[model samples]
Target: MKIAVDAMGGDYAPEEVVLGAIEAVKSYSLDVVLVGDTNKIKEVLNRYGAKDNSHLSIVHASQVIDMGEHPAQAIRKKKDASIVVATQLVKDGACDAVVAPGSTGAAVTAALLGLGRIKGIERPCIATPIPSKKGITVLLDSGANANSKPKHLVEGAIMGSHYAKYILGVDKPTVGLLNIGEEASKGNELAQATYPLLEKLKTISFYGNVEGRDIPKGTVDVVVCDGFVGNVILKFGEGMAMFIIRLVKDTIKSSGFIAKLGALAVYPALRTLKKRLDFTEYGGAPLLGVDGSFIICHGSSKAKAIKNAIRVAGELAQQDVVGHIRKSIEEEEVEQYDSEN
Candidate 1:
C-alpha cells in the first residue's frame, strides 16, 4: 500500500519526518508520497543518501499549520498546507492512507474537511491505544470533539469496537462507557442515556460502566467517553509515565555506589520496561469515522515514532478499517441506535 506523510508538520519538521518515511519505506515495503516543500524534503532525503529511492516521491505543499494556530481556520486559509495536502492525497485516492506527526488539531481538522465523515457518522473520533496490565485498552474520542453528546459517544463506541477487532485482533472486543460508577443509573445525563443504547447493540460487547482505574487495569478492551475526558486522561497518563521514569533516574544517580551496583543488576529489565512505556512503541492513534485512513502521531515524535506511525497507516489501509467501520454503522444494530433520532 502507498501512504502520504506530512514531511513538514512535526516539531522536528522535515528532518525527523523525512528520515522516518525513508526507514518506513525500507522496513514495510510500502511506497511513500512525502508532502511538503520539495526542497526541504529533498535536503533530508539527499543527506540520508536516499535521493533516488524508487519507493519514495515528493509532492510540494508550500504552507504549514503551526501547533498554536486554530485548526479549522488554518485549514481553510492554508489550503496547500502539508497536512492538508497529504490528507487530500488520501481523499483523492492517490494514496491509501495519510500519516500526520504534527499538531493533533490540524491533523483532525484536515481529515474532517478533506476526507469527510463516513455515512451515518456525525462525528469522527480518535481511537488511541493505551498499554495496560492485561493488554492494550482502546480509548475513543481522545481529542476529537471536546464536547460530545450521547449519540456521538455511541458512534465512537461502535467505531472503537471495530478498530479493536480489525487492527488489534480482538474477536469480540468488550466495550465500556466511562463513568463515575459501574451502575447503569450512575453518571450524568450523557452516561445514563448512553448506557442503555450501548447495551442494546448486538454488534459489540458492552461492559457496563468503568471507572478511571479500570482503564490502566485493562478491565475492558475499549473505553468510550467524550473527547474532553479522554484527552485529559491521555495527557495525565503521559505526564505521569514521564515523571516516574525521571524519578527513577534521579534516585539512581543520587544514590550511593552500592545502590548503583544493585541497579546494574536490573538494568536489562528496566530497559525493557522503558521500551514498553514508550509512546513510540504504540505507533499512533487512528482517527476513526472518517471516510479514509489517517494516523496521527505525537507532535514530539522522532524517527522511531514516525516510522511506526507509517506502518500503522499501512496496516489500517491493508485491513480496510474504514470499510469495516462503515459496514458496522450500516448494520441493523446501529440502525436501532439511530432510530431514536
Candidate 2:
C-alpha cells in the first residue's frame, strides 16, 4: 500500500515527519509520498540516509494551514496545502490513504472537501480508539460535528461497530450510548431520542446507555456520543491521565528513601504502564464516513507517533474500511445528507 503524509502539518514539521515516514518505510512493506515543500522534505530524507529510496517519494505542496486559520476557509484558499494535497492524493487514487498530523479542524475539512463523504453518511465522525481496562474501546463523533441528531449517532454506531470488527478484531462488538445514566429515560433530549434508535438496530450490538465511568471500565466496546460531548470527554481523559502521573511523581519525591527504593524495584512495571498509556502506540484516529481512508494524528506528534500513524493509515487502506462502511450503510438503508453541498 502507498500512503500520502502531510509532511508539513505537525509541530515538528518536515524534520520529524520525514523521520517518521522513513522509519515506517523501513519497517513496513509500503511506499510513502511526503507531501510538502520539495526541498525541505528532500533535506530531511538526505539527513536520515533515506534519500533516493524507491519506497519513498515526495509531492511538493507549497502552502500549509496554520493552527490559527479557519479550516474550511484555509482549505478553499490554499490549494497546495500539504494536508489538502495529501487528502487529494487519496481522492485521486494516487495513494491508498492520507496521514495528517495537523489541526483536527484542518484534517477534517480537507477530508470532507477533498474526498467527500460516503453515500449514506451525513457528517463524518472521528472514530478514536481509547485504551480501556479490557482492551481498546472505539469512541465515535470524537470531534466531527459539535451538534448531531439521533440519526447521526446511529450512523456513528454502525461505523464504530464495523471498525471494531475489522480493525480492533472483535467478534461481536457491543455499542453503548454515552449518557449520564444507564436507563433509557435519562440524559438530555438528544440521548433520550438516540436510545431507542440504537436499541432497535440489529446490525450492531447495542448495550443500552453507559455512564462516563463505564468508558474507562470497558463496559462496552463502542461508546456513541455527539462530537461536542465526545470531545470534552477525550480532553478530560488526557488531562486526568497527566494529572495522575504528576501526582504519583510528587508523592514519590515527598516520601522517604524506602518509597524511592520501592519505586526502583517496580521500575520495569512502571515503564510497561507508561508504554500502554502513550498515545503514540495507538497511532492516529480514523476519520470515518469519508469516501477514502484518512488518519489524523496529534499536532505534537514526533517520530514514533508519526511512524505509528502511517502504519495505521496503511492498515485502514488495506482493510478497505471505507468500503465496509459504505456496504454497511447501504445494507442498513441509513439516511443520507446533501453531500454535494
Candidate 3:
C-alpha cells in the first residue's frame, strides 16, 4: 500500500523524515510518496542509499506550513505545503494512509477539514497506545478535544475498544472510563451520564470505572476520557516514563561493586523496561473517526520513530480501521460532532 508522508513537517525536517521513509520502504516493501521539496528529499534519499528504491516517489510542494500557523488558515493558504498535499493524497484515494511527525494541532485540523469525519463520530479521538502490565492500553481522546459531553465520552470508549481489538489484537478488549473513583457513581456529570451509555453497547466489553492509578496496572485494554482529561493523563504517563528511566540510570551508576553486579544481572530486565517506557515504541497515535487513517507522531521523533510511524500507517491500511470504525459507529447510532467551525 502507498502511504503519503509529510517530509517537511517535523523538527528535523526533510533530512530525518526522508531517511525514515526510505527505511520504511526498504524494510516493508511498501510504496511511499514523500511530499516536500523534491530536491532536498532526493538529496537525503541518496545519502541513505535509497534514492533508487523503486517503491519510493517524491511529490514536490513549494511551501511548508509552519508549526505555529493556525491549522485551518494555514492549510487554506499553503495549498502546496507538505502537510496539505500529503493529506490530499489520502482524500484523493492516491494513498491508503497519511503519516506525519509534525504539529499535533495542525495534523488534527488537516484530518478533520481535509478528509472529513465519519457520520456518527462526533469527534475524532486521538488513540495513544500506552504500555501496560498486560501489554498495551489504548487511551482515546488524548488531546483531540479538550471539552466533551457524556455522549462524546461513550463514543471515545467505543472507538478505543475497536482500536484495541483490531490494532492491538486484544480479544474482547475491556473498556475503562478514566475517572476520580472506581465506583459507578463516581466522576462529574459527564462521566456519570456516560456510565450508562457504555453499558448499552453490546460490542464493547465494558469494565466499569478506572482511576488514574489503574492505567499502568493495565486495568483494562481501553481507557476512555474526554480530550481534556485524556490529554492530562497522556502527558502524565509520558512524564512518568521518562522519570523512571532517569531513576534507573542513576541507580545503575551509584551502586556498589556487588550492587553493580546485580545491576548487570538485571540488565536484560532493564532493557525490556526501557522499551516499554519508550513513547516511540508504539509508533504514533492514530487519528480515529477520520475518513482515512492519519497518524500523528511525536514532534521530537527521530528516524526510528518515523520508520515505525510508516509501519503503523501500513497496518491501519491493511486493517481498514477507518472503515471498521465507521461501520461500528453507524450500527451503534453513536452521536458525532461537527469538527469544522
Candidate 4:
C-alpha cells in the first residue's frame, strides 16, 4: 500500500516535511509519494544523504494553502496545493492513505468535500490516541467539529471505540462520555441526551459518564466529547505534561546533595514516565468517518513524528478501519431499530 504526504504544509515546511518523507521511506518497505515542489523537496532529501530514491517518489504541487486561508475556497481555487493534491491522490486511488500537518481546517474540508464520508456518517470526527496511566485512551472530536450535537457525540463514541479496538488492539474497549461528573445525570443538555443512545449501543462496552480526571488515569478506553471540549482537554493535558516536566527538572537542580542523589537514583524511571506522557508518542490524530484513512500530525512535527504518522496511516489502511467502522455502525443501527419495534 502507498501513502501520500503533503510535504509543504507544516511550520517547518519543506525541510521537516521532506526529512520526514525520506525517513518514512527508508524505515519502511512501503512506497511513499511526497507531494510538494519537486526541487525544494529534493534539496531537503539530499541534505539527509537520502540518495537512493528507489522507494520514494514526488508529485509536484506548485501552490500552498496558508494555515489561515478559508479551507473550502482555497481548496477549490488552489488545485495544485500539496494538501489538495495529496487528498486527490487518495480519491484517484493513487494512494491508500493521506497525511497532512498543514491546515487542520483545510485538511478536514478537503477530505470531506473531496473523498467524501463513509455511507451513513453525518460528519467525520478527529480521534487522537492519548497516553494514560492505564495505558492509552482514544479521544474523539479532539479538534474537529467543535460545535456538535448529541448524535455527533454518540457517533464519536462508536468511532472512538472502533479506533481503540482496531488500531490500539483493545478488545471490547470500554466507552465513556467526557463530562464534569461520573454520575449519570451530571452533564448539560448534550451529554444528557447522548447518554441513553450510548448506553443502548450493544456493540460497545459503554461505561457511562467520565470526567476529565478519568482521562489521565485511563479509567476508560474511549472518551467521547464535543470537539470544543476534547480539544481543550487535549491541549490542557499537553501543557500540563510540559509544565510538570519543566518543574521536575527545576526541582532536581535545586535539590540538596542528598535529594540530588535520590533524583539520580530514580532518573531512569522518571525518563520512562516522561516518555509515556509525551504527546508526540501518539504520532497523530486520525480523521475518522472519512472514506479513507487521513491522519493529521502536529504542525511542528519533525522527522520522527512524521515517520510515526506515516506508519499510522499505513496501519489504518491495512486494517481497513473505515470499512469496519461503517459496518459496525450499520449493524448497531439495525439492532437498535429492531429492538424499538
The lDDT leader among the candidates is 1
lDDT of each: 0.90, 0.90, 0.86, 0.85
Q: 1-341, model 4: which lDDT tens digit per residue?
A: 79999989878888887787787877877888899999998888788887568888899999998988898899889988899899899999999999988778888988897789887677689998889888898888998887777777777888888888888999889999988887888888888878888888877899999988888889999999999998898899899988998799779879888878888887788898888887766778899988988998888788778888898899899988998888977977732332211
Candidate 2 lDDT, 1-341, residue by residue in tens: 99999999979998999999999999999999999999999988999888989999999999999989999999999999999999989889999999999799999999999999999888899988887999888888899999888889988999999889888889999999999997889999989988887887778999999999888889999999999999988888887877887788778867999989887876677677777776557988999999999999999999989999999999999999889888888877776422221
lDDT of 1 by residue, 1-341 (tens): 99999999879999999999999999987999999999999999999999999999999999999989998899999999999999999988999999998889899889999999998888899999998998899998898988888878888999999889988899999999999998999998888888988887778899999999999899999999999999999999888988997888779868989888878886787788888877667889999989999999988989889899999899999999899888878883454445233
Error of 1 at 213 (Å): 1.0
Leading candidate by TM-score: 2
Q: Give the clashing residue pairs of candidate 3, or none.
A: 121-336, 122-336, 122-337
lDDT tens digits, residue span 41-159, model 3 = 98999888888888999999998878788877888777788888899999999999999788898889888888999888777889999887887888888998988877777778877
- Which regions of candidate 2 fall more than 4 Å away from where they truly are? 336-341
TM-score of each: 0.96, 0.96, 0.94, 0.93
Off by over 4 Å in 3: 261-271, 336-341
Candidate 3 local distance difference test against the native: 0.86
Query: What is candidate 1's local distance difference test score?
Result: 0.90
Clashing pairs in 1: none
How far out, in Å, is residue 167 in model 2?
A: 0.9
